[model samples]
Target: MKAMEWYFPKSREELAELLKEEGALIHAGGTAIKEERIKSAKRVIDISSLPLNYVKKDGNIWHIGATATLNRVIDSLESDHFLVKALKCTATTPLRNRITMGGSVYLSPLWSNLMGPLLALEAEIEVLGRRQGTCKYEELLSDRGKFQGCAVTEVRFPDVKLIGWFDRFARTSTDYSALTVTIALSVEGESIRDAKVVVTGSKKVYDRLSGVEKALQGSRLEDVDVEGISRNVNVEFTDKPAGSGAYLAEVSKVLLCRGLNALGSAR
Candidate 1:
């Protein structure tokens, strides 16, 4: 390990200017700057000391600060059963403590436990100093890697009328998931009016699970075609010797079914 310089940015504007200087990684919770070694960063800007670590909810919008730890969000969401289910189904307690939701967005982790639910909920991110504007969650996490040198200010999730269900099939609860499925279902009178299904950890960078969403939309629970559900699914996966596409597809199916059965049927 080498001696690295540290800058403590006390404000969002200060953090933005520091980011413009280059070579420093935005330190949220100080977990990834050392552990993940994101791009061999030498200088670290401690964003934790700033005012970015807050979780606020006002009317229809939930505002989560950039440095807010996952545990904080989990604790807050416990009252909202839907959000609580999503957090509980994410990673284990230890990682959740160190893992800031902002870090997870910028990192755009492959087997991310956060992206699945966040994407389904249509979360929007606010980045400063580089991608210095509010952008859609998918846009921020796009392959262009807009978040490479960016610092997230916060993430905004608008309150919606959908009941969300998140399920991840890990080797174990403590282990990082091999894959995760989040289903935000809009059901009315035993029928799915609309659906947003997001699948993380596929052969591709990330999969939106548009196929499953299409099948369920406007279809009654009993009318959903089981055999044809995955036919048009645009799923892509890297063929790791350990986990093949077939295995992920199977897991996706099982988890999708579970989400649908729980949330899809809920009135």
Candidate 2:
């Protein structure tokens, strides 16, 4: 392994200049870099020196800087942010303190705990650098190539009546979920007026579950049929970490069912 040269840019201007290099990687909380498979990455742009580390409610949207840690996000929000709550279930305290929003978005690894929740939240990302790009939550989860050469400066979400539910199907508490689901529901008179179902931890990363959302939109909680859910829902495992596809499929269905059922019970 070669000794690496680190670049800590104190401003976006400097960071932007550093990105002109061919093999540079953005280092935010540095936890992901701490696990870097490569000894030398041309340059590690230490964004912690930059000014992208704050959370604020601006008008009707929550603007979150990329350097903000998972724990910071959880601590910063007072009102129950379903997305944050779901992410809190991802890792232990110390690990959460280092894993970053920007790092996660860039990595989008197989077992990402934040992806499903972010998908369900309908989050929007603001990127900086040579080329700028904006992608909807679903688009980001679906096509990662769109993010090439982009630096995530901020992520924003509109304020709404957000109800979030998360379930991690794991052998134990600390284990990563074999399958995880995050549900955001907006209901009126026990019928879902708007719903986002983010199912992750399978091979493909996540499913937006538009079909399920459409079915849920006008139906009351009591009318949400579990049998229909088992039949209607479909997600192909892009990468099956857990063995037995059929078994995991059943487990995924059960976890999603319970999560949705919990949302109904809360009403």
Clashes per candidate (backbone, < 3 Å)? 2, 3
Candidate 2 — which residues are off by over 4 angstroms? 1-3, 34-38, 238-241
Best by TM-score: 2
**Per-residue lDDT tens digits of candidate 2, residues 43-75?**
677788778888889998888888988788888
Worst 10 residues of 1 by lDDT: 233-242
Model 2 lDDT at residue 125: 83
Q: What is the Cα-based lDDT of residue 189 in candidate 1? A: 78
Please give each candidate's TM-score.
0.87, 0.90
**C-alpha lDDT values of all predictions:** 0.74, 0.75
Q: What does candidate 1's lDDT look like per residue over 1-267, in tens digits? A: 887788998877888888887777777665555555754767878887888788889899999988788789888764554556656665678877888878877876654467777788888889887668888888876754666678878899877677787777666666666777777877787777888888877866568877688878888876676557755665665555447777777767777777666653554
